[model samples]
Target: MLYDRIGVGYAHGRRTDPRWLAPIVAALGDARTVLDVGAGTGSYEPLDRTVVAVEPSAEMIRQRPPGAAPVLRAVAEALPVRSGAVDAVLALLTVHHWPDWRLGLAELRRVAPLRVVLAYDTRRHADFWLVREYVPEIARLELSRPSAEQIAEELGADEVVPLPVPWDFADGVFPAHWRRPRAYLDERVRRSCSALAQAPPAAVERGMARLRADLDSGRWEREHADLLAAPEWDAGFRLLVSRR
Candidate 1:
């Protein structure tokens, strides 16, 4: 319901970054049949696999390209598929949005022997320049969701792989624009990030005003000069893989 409102233009900024694809596909391994839970716009769905998607937002589902995976309107806590129906289940950057992430993890475990989740460590992500300096409220909001470690523990994960955000990462998620500060100034980019979209408007407005002033006055550049030389930084994203 929340996404149906904010997800209107999701496809515009939520394209897949190839850097993430290699690791995700590798985690999937030999799984021929894959279930993509909370699959928004069908990004990162392997084209060679037999993929079925489950998404709650009609707006997001509608934006799926014409030949993308067939999807069912369903929640992660209640997947429609039978037990062990697929070789693997993929939940990408969507677990935080679930009302009950524990129940959703249970459902993911029930449906497949292999589970792959893309999640973040709230503490680390909260330190990002955008969240730390600009929108501190987003950090408070992140505190309410399960962290990457917690999700990995619940899923009995075999591995928790760090996913460093490349400077030019294509996906416009919250931390994707760490190097490109200007990206956050765009209203459309902010709308695509659920954290920015859901954060209090007054807080966001105040933060943006300060950010704009800093950018115009060259203060941002002077403060974050070190970041400009880095090719990638860990924005706390992790790929949790469970093999049962």
Candidate 2:
């Protein structure tokens, strides 16, 4: 419920970047009827597909565009539709938020007539730049979020298509921010992440100060120069496309 209110203007700040989208859209692959589970403000949906969104957050639901897919107010643990109804199920960056992960996965298994697509960062990768130094509080906050391997099991996914994507300020929401330190310093971008949302404000303040000093002293650049150009880091962001 708390994440429902994450940042006042996310359509832009946390807008979906195309680098990740190209592959995600590919994974969704020709499914005419798609179910976007935990669809946040209808961010990653493909405009061409017929999408039915299920989200429990009132705040997030209201942000969906007027012409965007139809939305249903429901928790992931229990879906309103009958089994094997849709061509695919798509869940992105959201399994960690589920109160009952297995229950939600069970529902996912029950639905989706043929295939399912999912994206979530691995908790182990939370050690990326800001998460480890400027946002230690966020690291601790994310510890409870389930791992990628766990999600693979829950989806009963025959295979999870592997796509390693990273995010820098130049890119979208991703861990490659490990490469671009400046973006994490931005208030709007930081607001999109859950760990930052859960951290104590004072702790975040202190962390940011240290991060600022590192940037000012040229330490950050010297340390991660190569990363700045490196296209991707394995931040545990995995995509699972399942077939029924």
Measured by lDDT, the strongest candidate is 1
TM-score of each: 0.98, 0.90
- Runs off by more than 4 Å, candidate 2: 166-176
Model 2 lDDT per residue over 78-172, tens place: 99999988888888877888889888888887888554555555565567777676767676657778877888876767767666665443434
Leading candidate by TM-score: 1
User: What is the overall TM-score of model 1 with all chains considered together?
Assistant: 0.98
Clashes of each: 0, 2
Q: Candidate 1: minimum summed lDDT over ten consecutive residues — where?
A: 122-131
Count clashing residue pairs in model 2: 2
Give each model's whole-structure lDDT: 0.93, 0.74
| Residue 6 displacement (Å), model 2 | 2.4
Residue range with the least summed lDDT across 10 consecutive positions in model 2: 167-176
What is the clash tally of candidate 1? 0
